[model samples]
Target: MTVLKKLPIVSAVFRKVWLQIAVLLVILIGNILLDLMPAQKEDIHGYTLYKRWAAFLGIFAVTWILVRVVSVLRASSVMGSRLAPNISALLFTSLRILIFVLGSLIALDSIGISITPLLASLGVGSIAVGLALQDTLSNLFSGFYLYVDRPIAAGDWVRLENGMEGQVGRIGWRSTHLLSSENTVIIPNSKLSNSSVLNFNLPFPTASFNLVFSVSYQADLDRVEDTVRAAAESALRDKSDLSAGTAPIIRFTKFNETSVELTLILKARSFPDQSELRHEVIKRIRKAFRQEENLGLDPQRIFRLVSNQSDLV
Candidate 1:
């Protein structure tokens, strides 16, 4: 019954790779038959056939195992982090590629390929290419280090050193794609490695906003403060879409010659929509002030001068 239950599970997995399994089985059966044939009595070259089969099977098995191990490690719950998936994928892919390259070299060596000349030629070629494409190679290695460090991940909201802000879309071998507020930005991995990246999402889910505006100097100071605070409080009062418990603040920042500059700080549930929230606050304040009469005074004061002749009369 246990075996029967597993039959369904086996069937499901095999269904995806039925063709590969069929080919491997055929090769295995043929190799077995060649092995069983007598050395002197066989009509075909059984030894050569067995050697080719062994080489092919060994390489295939190694590649398959490496890929499977990578898949398992990536899906494991033990690795927990936003960047874990991308980091794991990069690490696993690099490991497998290295393993396959080394394995291929060994397999070629076993098959009587001269490795000494190959190594010497590759070394010289590597030096030449390294010098020619130093920047590109630097970025490539920097990307690898970034992957290992696990500082950023796809979908993370980050601020670049140059004042660019965006959510990471993809991490490629050469460049990292950013879905910025303005458009899609592609940053070379090399450039990113050296700079400071501020990951806002990792530290906090909610982002705060400070809206600054100026009102006429003649406006009632208390009413001006009240109006701005009332608008923010009312807009944030329902708190349906926005995150709760964020205190709304309104304060007079500085007194100017013609107007008073005020600062209003509020929390936004979504960081990327801060502009929208600012616009909403401005709109609400304008509408609220418009509804009330003489709430804010005009600060433009006019002065009249008397002539010297009028003073003498």
Candidate 2:
């Protein structure tokens, strides 16, 4: 039954592939025929006009085939698996334009048109244009590197070293779009490439949340650990955002003059889930502490004793 339902999609894909192959074959045959045609006696710029026209046609046909082949390869999983879809499409487009330009230049040169002056002028103009658009080009190349290196991708939750964190909306030519909690942040690709990025979605969707708090030194250590563990377990069981496979961990990290600092490490399904999971865990732990005997004092408050000197004065 499932096979029958998917048959139409498979057949459609096969049909499209066959059509592309037929077009490519036609282009090749046309190029072959153009090569076989006789050159006329009429000359343009010391070259046979018929030969020039035929060469131009042949170049166009070959360029068309190259573009078509690349487009087909890019559309298949073979290329798409290695590169992001957007990046792959961009590369294919640039490849097509490059092939077309080179072919056109070759055809023009074949017709006895001197390309030396044109090449020199293009070189000078390109340098000037490149200088004017230095920043833009930097971003463009950075964006290309980001797509190739793949430090982060669309829909991945990432945090920059500067404390900006969000889910990536898109990776553009000049900038990367991030959909943060309050607004969208447009970060230049060059800056992103230079900065340190923490991708929470990489390797896996599960993320760990660390919650630090201090307990009074007077409190029982074993009881505190048990209470915190129970609270975390309750949070995991009651909240849908928390990961059920990994158990909550409690660690005694530091001992201050007044209190013992502890950390509660919990697992969430994703970065966004951390907030809710932390909230629920903190609430549960606070409630548990309040209900327990002799464990609800503020850990930050310090007590001081001063001797009275008024009698001596």
Candidate 3:
């Protein structure tokens, strides 16, 4: 059709939603009124074929309206944190497909179409498609689970069970992108979903973790506590990268083979946000302990610390 001829048809279908509703209403109302007019079947095919078609058209219109509402919600819900906006988008699209399928089936059935053959063909086709794309579909559904369970999100620092640790770049339909210090890691959603992931940036950004250090056996316990606590408090107050949590506290936990172990609770703004912060805190504490000769390490520098409780930290 030429532009001029298409204008009327386009306006009727693509105008505001209320116009579509009005059109559907007119079709339904006119069909009802026609049925009541008591025309003989021999007079017009309008009594059978056309009437069924009109009812089918009405059903399809309502289906379109419902899918439109879902589309609007999907667009407006983009700002939901951690729920992966694209995942919501996929969800709405799936819902729209489902509505279209059901509406088409209902409309066809209303017009005396047999659905048995259609259903059998669909079942066979779906099985073939599923078998061919097993891995792809597995990843897709796993992405859906990630959206619902919310194990991680963009910008989170996560360590996967397979030993890939990084900031999440994005969670895509087929895979998740993670940017580490070394490289960007792309994980298939299926593996990520099944494996354990350690999220370092949850509940609070600046959460506390234990830092352990060893001191000489002869060090004064009382003075040691005061010195350590003073160092921790000073580091937290003066450092911008540290302390979004409780004030630092020191605890004399155990006696090791050669030295006394003390645990200091330290906070960070975010996981791996700064290696410099750890270095800075240790440097400050070491400088402070230099004045207190008794708090020095047995044979080496005083600040022999472990990070967040790995072996050497």
Candidate number of the best TM-score? 3
Of candidates 3 and 1, the better by TM-score: 3
Query: Candidate 1's C-alpha lDDT?
Result: 0.67
Tell me the TM-score of each prediction against the true structure.
Answer: 0.60, 0.73, 0.81
The clash count of every prediction, one per candidate, is 0, 0, 1
User: Candidate 1: minimum summed lDDT over ten consecutive residues — where?
Assistant: 304-313
Sequence-dependent TM-score of model 1: 0.60
Q: lDDT by residue for model 2 over 30-72, one digit each (tens)?
A: 6576556566524224335655665666666666666666666
Candidate 3, poorest ten consecutive residues by summed lDDT = 304-313
Model 1 over residues 248-294: C-alpha lDDT tens digits?
77777787676667767777766665556656666677666666555
RMSD of each: 10.8, 9.3, 6.3
Per-residue lDDT, model 2, residue 193, is 99
Number of colliding residue pairs in model 2: 0
